[model samples]
Target: MPNFKLTISDIKGKSVSKELKDSDANPLLGLQLGNETDASIVGLSGKLKLTGGSDKSGVPMRNDVHGSARKKILLSKGVGLQDAETGQRKRKLMRGNTVSEEIYQVNCKFNGELPVEAPAEETTEEKAEEKKE
Candidate 1:
């Protein structure tokens, strides 16, 4: 029973965030990075590829890792390591590619057109009030 924050991105570089409760998130469990799933589970009509995610402790997932557990690996340049100098390597903590209950945020890439949500229309009364000002 894990709640997850889904960050869905499109080809245009735009992203949308959606929330998934325990029930809705069940289908996403055990999924690893680079795996594709049906977006219909999230109320979308395209396929979504698992890019990456972070655990509750803010540990980022790395594709090279095999399981859902967290590990401290020697990373020179990758998902969990940042600002590495030339030929620099350090032991950093990172989560595995698999999605687990401890994962808080899930990153996904959409494969098709992302529907744009229209903004709410202003009521006649509200428009009249705005014109009066």
Candidate 2:
């Protein structure tokens, strides 16, 4: 499939955007943050700032308070293990070592109601104007 930027938005119409470089396979080449040898933070999620006024009084809303997880792939290149058969030199590869999941919480509303859909109907004066037109 095509790789496109993700623009996460909230109920108040505030949003945060993120773009990923085009890749042949996965498209979204996961960002290998921090030290590679230490651990691989794969699918960690976070929040972003919004542009409009605060959703809750003076408190601003966070756009992308998402959740994610991480996994351990192969061992570091230099952190080599003994060669089982060759006995010369080699590095052992380990599959999934450990996976970590994380969720970012933020203050925001996700109701499915729009501003135009106000519960109170238009006044009689407004309706009269419409009828006259």
Candidate 3:
């Protein structure tokens, strides 16, 4: 089975991840952007929602999330994440000493893997040997 990894990040620097096979994720992800060279094979279905955190009552907060028909998600690239905008205005309410907090605004992206690195030099080892009593 082909495995695809997805990384989700918020503006506040919080992140969540999910692993799904091509068959499972393909359905949730759209493919309208397949024709574009800049875009990847998977497109945002526009149904993805980010969580804003929760209230004192443990209720999940809600806010306005931005989306477009043209945005695409590159699963195995640099940032892996794409365009994401949190609502300018959060759902604010004030009453009974309960202070409303801003919800978490997040964007989803994907990760490829660690970049290849060259072998380390041994200059440090030589210097340490010279310094030994």
Q: Pick the candidate with the highest lDDT.
A: 1
For all candidates in order, the CA lDDT equals: 0.93, 0.28, 0.32
Models 1 onward score TM values of 0.91, 0.18, 0.24
Candidate 3 per-residue C-alpha lDDT over 1-133 given as tens digits, one digit per residue, 9 for 90 to 100: 3343444543355555555454654433322211111113334222333222332333332222122211222222112223435532323221111112221112243332222347887798798998994
RMSD to the true structure for each prediction, in A, is 1.8, 18.6, 17.4
How do the candidates rank by lDDT, highest first? 1, 3, 2
Between prediction 1 and prediction 2, the one with superior lDDT is 1
Supply every candidate's count of residue pairs whose N, Cα or C atoms clash at under 3 angstroms: 0, 0, 4
4-122 per-residue lDDT for model 2 (tens digits) = 23333545775444442334213222312111211111121332221221211222212221212222223323222333344344433221111111111111222232223248889
**Counting only residues 3 or more apart in sequence or on different chains, how many pairs clash (N, Cα, C under 3 Å) in candidate 3?**
4
> For model 3, what is the alpha-carbon lDDT of residue 42?
36
Clashing pairs in 2: none
Q: How close is candidate 3 to the true structure, as a TM-score?
A: 0.24
Residue by residue across 13-86, what tens digits does model 1's lDDT show? 88999999979999999999999999998899989999999998899999999999989899899787879999
Give the residue spans of candidate 2 off by over 4 A: 23-133
